[model samples]
Target: MGRSREKEDAESRFNSPVSISVADSSVSLLKLISILIIFVVGVVIGLVSSSHIDRYFSFRADQFNIKNIYFAADQFSSDSEKMLVNCERECALSMESFIRPLNLNHRMTDDELFWRASMVPQKEEFPFKRVPKVAFMFMTRGPLPMMPLWDRFFSGQDVDKYSIYVHALPGFELNVSNSSVFYRRQIPSQHVEWGSVSLVDGEKRLLANALLDFSNERFVLLSESCIPIYNFQTVYKYLTRSVHSFVESYDNPSRYGRGRYNRRMKPDIRLTDWRKGSQWFEIHRTLAIKIVADTKYYKLFKKYCHPSCYPDEHYIPTYLHKFYGALNANRTVTYVDWSLMGPHPATFTAVNITEGFLQSLRNNGTLCSYNTEKTSVCYLFARKFDSSALEPLLNISSQVLGF
Candidate 1:
């Protein structure tokens, strides 16, 4: 009891002095809190030094300029809009191309189709991005007697470079299988006779049919008897690159020329302006359009030209000679042995199917002005071949025609 009372008295003397160890610990605690405060302030200053660009604005802290943030936005939007428009345009063109071949089987819209087939842009303008093609148009009376020869000629060629059209006599059935080059190529045709307006009409129909395809750049008129003298490539190069059309045009003072002219065609087609040319012709797209577009002269020929007048002989020559004389080569690419015939040219039989005769036709000794001046290599096709020449032509096709 005495010891416990002595300890309580000592503690009551706490007011006199504090312990050294307790005082030192309190001072250490104060120093630690001061260091923490400095570190927190330093961190805040570092973050503020790396702030967003919005801080640079002078007037207000929250306000920012859109012109600075969206500088490239307008440009990006314009480019995206252009891309979208281009894609839409291209899609529309592709759709139209898919629908064109289907239109051929529909009813004849000959009058509404005239302007489309015949109207063309100026000489300097060409809008077809597609590769240009050659349209081989055959104005046959009926079945093609020399189709085998033609099949071989057209075989194994690039499908993109050429197209075929046959204006056969209505109801004339051909044995052409679906695999043939001429398969299903027959257009809606009417009856045609020699030396008549119907012949011209037939050729016009071919032009209109071929013109439906915008890619066709050159149009060739062929009869069933006609055979290509050169390979497709040679003929293609000769015609496709030709600046002037190859229609045998000349000033025929003979009874066949101006003699066939109707004086009623005075202001439209004067006798002096009248001309003569072969019916078989190779014309460019421009001339082909002009032919189809010719209501005035075609009317004149239909009214005036007779079998003796021979519209087939004088109509094309006179019209082309009037407007586009200088552009005409004044020659034909098709070879006809007119030396042996009356009104019609001589037809070739198996006897004339020798390699030497064909080679001579290809390299005739005569020179005619082609795309440029006269060249040694002239004829690309020949006409008036009989059906019997088919076998011989096929036999020598590989060795001679180079198909």
Candidate 2:
């Protein structure tokens, strides 16, 4: 009986509820600790990821905002084709009077300014006998691969008939002085944004810089990809004899075009006074000065325009048409193929470029008429060429185009 009691007691100890309770408590504690660790790690990762994304978007938004301001200003400045006659006088006279103080003050203060520099004359008589100097204003993002071809064109018999001014990106640090063509030829430039009012500002800035020197009679704005279809001599002769400026004007009714004309342009208070055109142009020195000096229109444009509508296309054309309809040939010298509809024009490919293509583009009779006798041959420059077309153009420079 004593032996049986001892065995039963040992079995009872093994089967007790106290031992089961201890095991359950240990498992529950382990699960809770595991969940805590996972939660902590997840929180840390989420915070770090959120910070990175927020920083990236913030940078983008800042850039976007700056660009928007520029576009709005440009749209506000452009004039509408329909309103050209009514707005031209206001654009010219108002802007000139507004900027006169700034110009006169700058002239009085700075000896190195453009107007002062215009007083100095070349020791040697001007080259190209009868031809006036054509100032090729290069508005570029970087080194032009086609510079060599331009070098050849400018290097022709009468080198002094043409001058080159490079308005490169502000941060592009390269020794341009080494090249004879670009020697002492750098103009002050700011960062230019695509589809922004900054482009109009940049162009105006370029005009101001050119006008300071005064020797630049004809100002032609060319991009990095632009190649001269005719030699410097031909271009110089063409410009000097021409009576009118080459600025394109068209009736733009698109949402981002003339349709966005501000209702708030003071004094006039009419939406019909706005306009639009291509950004490229060849302006006489008189027009260049008028543009730089403009204040009333500039203030109005800067105030009411927006990014939804691009103003560069309308500003110059509208302003020119309004003030100097007789001065402008009413056509752009730069050829751009807008057959393909998009924000950008059709980029010319290597395969598409040929002797035949060149002839066709050159012969295209889109010239604008001023009087019964004179016709301005429409396109002096064509753009958006693939970088590859450079070599072919160079090879045929002499044989094909006389450049």
Candidate 3:
């Protein structure tokens, strides 16, 4: 019976569901809780890591942006300051040129002495000096092929009333002496480059050189290609009788004309007050002095103006407008055509040189204004003519144009 009972117990134990111990159940529960804890910690660590990565990249991007802005601002400031320094140096050099002659009169050579003596202000003399000579200041790059033509024009009956001053390129080795018209009459030569501030400097230097020994009452700036369309008598009479200086004032909205503005010339002056005009001009002795004597306006212009920012187009116009608006005639004696788009003026070819064209150029409207008794005569000189046009211009000098 005992053996039977043991077999039945074994069968029951094997067939029936087994009962787990409390200790084992507790250990399994503890292991499950520990696993859940580990999973939660890993998830938290992943989120934190992702957030840190995003913040680090954002900070780097912001830093890069700031550096770019700072670099741009610094570059602009540096350029502006550099321009200012250059302008100041130029002005000082001009003053030195003017004053050196007066201080070192005996030490200077004939050319230098002449320049110095010319700058010295002459005391107002008795009854207005005999029609003061007009100095035709010519700025040229090479030999003026139109020399023969100019000779004919200048050799007119009243040619004695005027003198010629040629500012040729220093490096040019031309035989100007071959022509009596350009004989030993060359002024001190200097280097000049187109589309550069040196152009402005060259002009000033020419004026200074001419002023040195010549007692010119009137100064007319002209280019190599320029030709007189009127008789010498008419031009001289017109200039001597003029009451105000002649300089053209026009609106130039291009990068070169507009870029000359600066914050340094503010409050008292504004960009809107800025103006532009032809590089050529005709002025009285008094106006010439005013230009040379200027310090404040010149300093401001040179600093803020450049090649991209053509100070030449702005400097003279702005200074004259600001200081001597009343004295200015508000018209340029030099004629230019900006109708065709290019870096240079419209060139008149041989084909374009006709009697009609010459007549049209000489035609002055029959209108009267301040100091004008009748019609307003147009420009004294026209430019950008090809060297070949010299023959056509000379052919019609006396018959139609009266030069």
List the global CA lDDT of all models: 0.80, 0.70, 0.70
lDDT of 2 by residue, 150-189 (tens): 7788774564466667777877744655656766566666
The number of the candidate with the highest lDDT is 1
Candidate 3 lDDT by residue in tens digits, 26-62: 8999999999999999999999999999999999999
Consecutive 10-residue window with the lowest summed lDDT within model 3: 98-107
What TM-score would each prediction reach against the true structure? 0.73, 0.65, 0.66
Instruction: Name the candidate, 1 or 3, with the larger TM-score value.
Output: 1
Deviating ranges (above 4 Å) for candidate 3: 1-122, 126-129, 156-160, 177-179, 250-256, 267-269, 364-374
Please write out the lDDT profile of model 1 over residues 1-403, one tens digit for every residue: 9999888888868644567667888999989988888888888877786464336654353344555434545455565455444545664567455323523433466665666777664665554456778999999878898887777777888877898988888888666898898887888888899878888888888888898887788999999999998888889888889998888878777676666777877788887888788888999888888888889888888987877787887888888998888877878888899896587889899998999988899886887776567788877899889989989998898898797
What TM-score does prediction 2 earn? 0.65
RMSD of each: 16.1, 22.0, 21.7
| Candidate order, lDDT descending | 1, 3, 2
Clashes of each: 0, 17, 2
